[model samples]
Target: MPENIVIIGTSGAIGSAFTRRMSALHPASKIHAFSQSSTPTSEGNITYHPICYADEASIQDAASLAAETGPLDTVIVATGLLHEGDIRPEKSLKDLSAKKFMKIFEANTITPSLLAKHFIPKLNRDNKATFAAISARVGSISDNRLGGWYAYRASKAALNMILKNAALETARRNKNAVIIGLHPGTVDTDLSKPFQANVPSGKLFTPDFAATKMLKVLDSLSPQHSGKIFAWDGQEISP
Candidate 1:
């Protein structure tokens, strides 16, 4: 029997790319994709669930729907916020607004954390399971070289912590489950477009390329590797 997968943030570049890849790799598997927009036209093994990452009710509804279907074999959270209009100031910290920082946390950290809290319990314990969150490498305090994007960095860091803690808790009940935080590298998405100029040549990755690498990493993971943070290139990142 094929596995059941739940993909959050299905409208985003990386999320959409994963959906396409998974459709080809696991055609028999049921895929539940959550996005803020209405369902898009696609001929794949996908079920669209309209969900707003910023809304608590929408998150709960999505989780409840997943539970109703059956035990979730895998759940990949691709939701994140790089920029949120003028709410997130383009200027330095001197001009930063608390509201913008909080908004970033809501999207990047709180949203995924809430999903894990509600959905991990719905994962199948009879077999192996995986819960992966798309975190940014900038979230690693030890890896921080240049200082900028404070809100984005802080939010992702919080997400990493939450995923780690969730992994520990989930392990008690589902010993075979693997919870991980993944960084999709500098993909050519709206979130990374503005910052791509600084990226070295041949270092920037397309969403498809990043998704491929991420899937490889996910496939290689085991329960022993749970709670670890990994980059798209398959390298382990500091917490």
Candidate 2:
């Protein structure tokens, strides 16, 4: 059967790239793209929906509508918020604030959790299914040796926990559903623009390149790999 894929945060760099990648990889797959901003017009097998990640009603509506087309085999939460107009990651303890911390948690942790809540029901139980969130390597508590961006790191860590919990629950009901957290590495997207100065040549990946690596990793997961965080190259990251 042809795949049915749902991509939340489709207006972002990585999300848009995944949209294109999926369309190219599976011409017959139904790709339902959602974003907080106005997405481009639907064309070919791709359909666009406006969504607010903070609003449960919008997410539920989008998932409900997307489910009408076909059973969902894959759902990717590509939403991320490294910084806004004034909300950048804290460099030290003095830079921390409750509001900024909450904002980070809202985007990194809550968004993907809510996506699973509404869309996991549509996952294919009788066959393979995937639920993946675009997480950062900084999210790994065991791997954090530099330690500076407190809020961003903590929120992603929380997101990792959420992914693990979701994976365990999904396995209890549907052994084939692989819920995971993914690190796209240092991709050349708006999210990484301000920080890309330090990235060495050949290290910064384009959105398309990152998306391709992620697709291959997602395709290779099995029941044993659920509840884990993985890098772009397919190695598992420590929690």
The C-alpha local distance difference test score for the whole of candidate 1 amounts to: 0.85
Q: How many residue pairs clash in each candidate?
A: 0, 0
- On TM-score, the leading prediction is 2
Tens digits of per-residue lDDT for model 2 on 1-239?
43899988888899999999999989988989998886556799998888888789988898898889777899999998889888887888999999998888999888888998999888888888888999999998889998889999999999999989988888898988889999999998877889999999899999999999999999888878999999999999999
Q: Any runs in candidate 1 off by more than 4 Å, and if so which?
A: 40-42, 87-91
Residue 203 error, candidate 1, Å:
1.3
State the weakest 10-residue window (summed lDDT) of model 1.
84-93
Q: lDDT for every model?
A: 0.85, 0.89
| TM-score for predicted model 2 compared with the true structure | 0.97
Error of 2 at 5 (Å): 0.7
